[model samples]
Target: MVTLRLKGLHRVKAKGRIYWYAWRGGPRLTGAPGSPEFLASYNEAVANRQSSDSGRFRSLIALYRASADYKKLAESTRRNWGPWLDRIAGHFGELRIAQFDRSDKIRPVIRRWRAAYAETPRSADYGMQVLSRVLSYAVDPLGKISSNPCEGIKQVYSSSRSEIVWTDSDIAHLKKTCSAEIAQAVDLAAHTGLRVGDLIRLSWSHVGEDAMIITTGKSRHQREAIIPLYQGLRDILGRIPKRSPVILTSSKKRPWTVNGLASSFSDAKKIAWPKGDDLHFHDLRGTAATKFYVSGLTEREIAEIMAWEEEHVARIIRRYVGRQAAIKERIQKLNEARKS
Candidate 1:
């Protein structure tokens, strides 16, 4: 029979095999070495192979090592999945991959995450999505698991409460209250529905004499977005230095972080706009869409210009198209008067 020993530790031996029992007294295995029965058999085979000088133990070690899934995931995907993977690793504490029942293993984690983020359900939902993506890679690419544990988990509910649209008076108040530069950024965002990311990344090269082409950052699917240089927006762009690529950068010429922009915007609003009329930077996008709808642009046309789904046109039309028909009638009357 094979003798088993550890440095200041104990081991079990049976049927000419030896094994170092797990120190924590949990299971007879450590770190995904296959099933408990498989581990036992592997130990016996190792002892036999050592006595016979066979390659059986070496081949089994290679096969078990090959079963690890983390190697197959892409670098970018691994970076994105890192936090979730670390959490899972921390909770399990070196458990065997084969020992886990996908649902039973992850459901409790999800439950705890949900409870923690009860007030902000979106955070919980995002956590689940991150976990699901990692599990998908583990099951599909790594082949460590036959099925993804993330499958069929009910997606956490989130609210989509619509934000109030900024009014003309609000815009005027903001312009009057903010510094010339901050007011320009506010005005440009109001005129174009470009995201804050796209807004900050904009370079002088993107802005020609007649129009501005924003390299969109949201989906990065649209390639580039085209916005006409209206007279007011052109005047703002003119005020910015010709050499600076970013239109709204700080003195260091670096792009604004979301928090940085939000803080600047908050300070600007507090000084310029009246109380109780405060709005977010995103509200400018809504205001821009509202203006476009009221300016005789069709819903389909607005969707194209704004990169919004066509389904949103109805709600936008309802919100902004009020009183526009009267304005159109007045314009028609003015044209008839000129003709007469």
Candidate 2:
């Protein structure tokens, strides 16, 4: 037997199995050691780590990508940030990290790069956010920068979705026109107020006699969102067949991936409301909040259930419930006038 040692090749043992990685905390290498497939993967990972613009933003970005800080981020967040990181690298890769110490010098440049995506304000803002995270990592962990220039940069996109709850008409039309999967998704979202990611991951095990309990996917604190088992939610759950451990399944009876669910929902939206006002799957959160408010839940109680700020819950009630309450009052007045 021959022992082969390769530079930067790391080996580890865990749970009675040995594993090989390209480098410590780097990408895992597959195939038997010394095999062609293993060598190829190792080489690719090493090649990616070599930065042509060393000591510059490109190198910093590379280091950030490999750091636990980046890896520990939510999978969806990492996926969303990947492209923006590339864009930041392309734009500022050659700029020396020392240059970022001066906020005035780097802030304007970042803003200018952000302006390129102004037509899509949300994308523009997201790009800024991703860039900021990388730079923040550099400042704290790497000590490459004196300060983060992205601080206090005003986001170009401002949105108030208080009025965006799905109406009964919209839900009815969606149920009639969309596929069963999409209809169930909408119903589950409206009733439980779970984000799409959480909704897709919901299972029968999470349901209790009085409430559904699960850790929210996007919560930084991994907080458990406890939603009471309302009749509407129970009815929606009763109608769904237990094809998989996950409550929501695709048309093929497999668990729903985020992209899979979004693509299908987008198509369903077009067919179901071709001429109607815009509605998003996320709006169902507001719908659920409204329902909770109308059912006599206080803002603080709804906030706890939804894992949202109490202020945000209040805003949802003021927008949705306030209008409904006013309408009910007007109808009562109309009936009284008719009697007079």
Candidate 3:
């Protein structure tokens, strides 16, 4: 048995093996002693659990944590929710859920978030949205909270992007300079209009002979995606040797984790755009939308390819590429009039 000196922490031996456990009966530690899990679990077990039944806030959060809905969420989603929910639990955890009214408590908390994360105001907005959802759930047929305090909370954050489309020259330079891995990622994003998350998670099975099917990530709805497998995407996939279940692997031949992929792309981007253009991996989706428009696809057809709403597609094409086309046609007509 390996013994480590730590408060409220000990190792138990059974069948010639030692296991770490919290001294008092708490959740079993999952990692090696003195690891991240050990320290977190130790602190959790030994921390003060002084809250009583006086407030339904913590209790309601606990109930929601154990609900089927929270449990069934995708791994990436639940991971994103952890820190946000933990913050909410820490902020008003001891207050009664029914008393979360906009007149005082809720607005104050929202303002605090807005002020604290002024640089990333979107994060603060997201926190309010999360709180609102919990409040809505509490006000549902199952719970005692009568109203959602987060209703009509103004979204002060503007998510407008000045992302420029990657020209053919830009894409060619990126493919030549970038590693074979990320180059392929860029190509798939441009041709198929898939997000980085979806690209990294894509499998050989998802790519049929003529079309690739996908379940989109990071959307309110898990949209069914079906984009045709064009020659560009076909050539990219054909050359890559399959080492993992995921189609795109890292230089180490392992499947790319989301953060890992981002880091790699960041490095590749510096090489590709040395002058620091305002392009990102996601900007390829807009590039794809433009390319579809130039190829004579209607907004409705482009919407189907990208799995986006028709109105959004129409607006984007009109604002960016389609308007330019219309202006050029007007100029051509004016030239003909002058000739007459």
Candidate 4:
């Protein structure tokens, strides 16, 4: 019997076969010695393990990825964080976390990412935010890093793009060119005031006889709500075949991954919406909220219906609610005062 010692390779015997896995955490890889696949797996594992043990960015990110808090993040947020985190881990991942904690040391790295992603300032800013969280996690629970370098770094806000309520024309155009799944996704997003992430995860079980009853996942403090199963949303739901556990499915009848949904929707937008300024799926949620307000629902009432905070509902009203209607209400007060 020979004792095998490989830095990142752990050999385990299962079902009369041996398997190798990266010591830190990753997918399993198998390659017999002297085989090309084995060599590639070994090399890749060694690299990942080296970075993992180096007490660097990947090490901290790995910890954060495995955290319960990470799982608690909305699917959209988690999806957004992953790429930015990976990019940060790639550039600064080699440095020790302590080394990364130094403001002076990390400034240059931050500057480069900012410069590189200058066209999309929000992405750069979000990268900094993700870095801040990763460092914070390392400090509180993992206790590996002492300071958060992302805190002091200034971030820009160029990603703030205004949204338009999808018009009847817009819906008609989309319906003409897009698949039923994507078009229905559009309808569901606008008709229900739920975020795209929440809408995509809606299940058959969440369906009620006259309403959609489910807990939304936009924020950490999740709240359940029941929106009436109106004709539009009900039509979309009724038409979608029960292919997977979730109501929203791809043309293949498979469930959508966050990236897949984003990509598919983006493609749909480009093809079906070639005429003017494109609308984001999230704008539909805002559009729904504004409709709720114009339909004479109070901000608090809207909040209750949407399972959102009153403050959030108010914010949406401030941005998108009809100003003419607001002025009309104010004029009624003036008329009352004259009558008095």
Candidate 5:
């Protein structure tokens, strides 16, 4: 008898019957060990696994990861995109580049994959965005595909938060109910109009006599955000003890992580509001924009300070200041009628 050694050949015994496989959980092999049919199946499976196009999605993803375009994305953006890229690769790794070029054929398949996370519309949209970016890269620099199938796909989630501004009462309640750290965090965010990530990363060194000038984190230090130091902001800053290099620290006197601060804020919100707690930390940006409008800052100035579009600044003003003007006019009319 002769013994034959085979790579990636797996054998299983079940119910008193022996079965051969190319590998565990891989295609089943036909015929006896060393038989022509068995060898053929094993060779075919191994060849498929070794083919360049077997992991075409992964290969494209690798090229994109190394490309200058992907490298230029903000650090936080890249971090958020990492998992979605992995999911795309996992779902489509075995596909050929030619298949992606057939937009009609591939679009339905991509949609089906996206539909799996339909319950999480935001997440699904994010995944779609990542997939679209990858496919766009393939279309342009790689030339592996003719067009992006994800182009012009309607996003499932839509929201309008223009009217959502944090009230003074909401701030007072948060300050009263939450810890000193969280309270200071809220005040800093309300005054500076910084995003949560930027807020946590703000340092005392960024503060100057007239204004706090620092390049925004989201801009990858390419654009500067200039926040004026008003009396209210000065008062808030004067009260906070600098325990770390960063202005806002955890209860442990360490720099705040984004998730840590968000979790803390969420718990504080639950305790303070208990119900009807629709306000978010991001709403502080809108509140600060409203404050800027009231302080006589032009729409352009406010937009520059907050790195927002002028149209967005105008919308905030309309929602808050315009409404106030309407209410004041109504009251004046009522008072005049009473006097008559």
Candidate 6:
């Protein structure tokens, strides 16, 4: 039952889309301010209350409502999803709420966006996914549209296909060459398989007597990773002062950004080994998942430990478990030879 009333569309000089002052007093436009075509389109949509159908408009209204219930998301989830929401807003900020439908007109827009970001499939996939969700929510339950245009969109953009699993040497080098904070970050990634975004911001409060209870941003699963207080992690955690809220932090004792940590990890990797960029922090999670998978842990168990959905685990296996079967077969042959 979301309603949007159009105000006047004004032309902006730079990269401006249509700007409509809503009945609720918020401005809407398709693109960022200052794009020429954006300004013209904003004015056109506002002037005539264009009855044209668009999925973008419906999606925006749903997003607005969803944002109102922000508390439902974890702090990290909010931080990550915010950018996607902004990008969607930038593309369809000014459309009439009621005019949203699956139209051929928007296909080219999606196609263009997909093409522009062909190299980075993950970003493109995320954009499409957010758009799809928005549109799905906008569709009337009474069969207004036969189907969502976003259906069957390829996930080539947001996939783990490009991800690389870390080797033992990579782990050893990172531990040896990185700073204390960075080393701790690497250890946590290795042991817990948490993302840099989640690991760097983790606090003593999230740790309990037996395990580290982490909430993932990529999904809603609440995972409690049990890293049996081994000497290394225990020693590292023992060194932290009682006053700090996080495990890895700056001299000022603040959380680190994912990019910042990734940069540091990269620098440390370069100094520690010949191939610094061979692996990413995310690969640690993949490695851990592989370890569990090899140990005959069910996909559900791996997902529980990693805080990923079941399908995500399957996807990871398909993408990265290349040598697992070969290694298992080699072991089997060795065992048969020994028995003979």
The TM-scores of all predictions, comma-separated, are 0.51, 0.68, 0.64, 0.60, 0.67, 0.61
Q: How do the residues 140-192 of candidate 3 rate in per-residue lDDT, one tens digit apiece?
A: 84556667767766776865553367778988887878998887777778888
**Root mean square deviation (Cα) for candidate 2:** 7.2
> Which residue pairs in candidate 2 have backbone atoms (N, alpha carbon, C) closer than 3 angstroms, thus clashing?
none
Question: Ranking by TM-score, best first?
Answer: 2, 5, 3, 6, 4, 1
> Taking the tens digit of each residue's C-alpha lDDT, what string does model 4 give over 175-255?
888888888788777778787667778889988888888887666546876687767677777777888889889998887
Better of 3 and 6 by TM-score: 3
lDDT of model number 1: 0.59
Q: Is candidate 2 or candidate 6 better by TM-score?
A: 2
* Cα RMSD for predicted model 6: 8.0
Please give, for residues 1-340, the per-residue lDDT of candidate 1 as tens digits: 3343422222445445654433311123332234556456446544533453212222222232234444354333434444554344344423455533457876675577556766777766766776565456556655666776667777567333234566778778777767655766677788887787777677778787777876566544454566778786787777776546567775455666666777888888777754545467886787787677656577787766666667987776554443554376558779889999
Candidate 6 local lDDT, 150-261, one digit each (tens) = 7755676444533467767767766776787777676667667677667877788887786677776554444555444546557767776654677777545667777777
Q: What order do candidates take by lDDT, descending?
A: 2, 5, 4, 3, 6, 1
Give the per-residue lDDT digits (tens) of candidate 2, residues 1-340.
Answer: 5365779877767445787877764556878888888888888778867735677788887788889898788766765676677678879988888888899888889889999999999999989889899889988988888789999899998875666788788899888879998989998998888888889999999999999998887776477789998787889999999999999999999999988999999988888778756688888987887777666577788878888766676665665543664466568678889999
**Which ten contiguous residues of candidate 5 have the minimum total lDDT?**
317-326
Q: Candidate 4 — worst ten consecutive residues by lDDT sum? A: 158-167
Judging by TM-score, tell me the better candidate of 1 and 2. 2
TM-score winner: 2
Error of 2 at 107 (Å): 1.8
Q: List the residue pairs that clash in candidate 3.
A: none
**Best candidate per lDDT, number?**
2
Select the stronger candidate by lDDT from 1 and 5. 5
Give the alpha-carbon lDDT of every model.
Answer: 0.59, 0.82, 0.71, 0.72, 0.80, 0.61
Number of backbone collisions per candidate:
2, 0, 0, 0, 0, 18
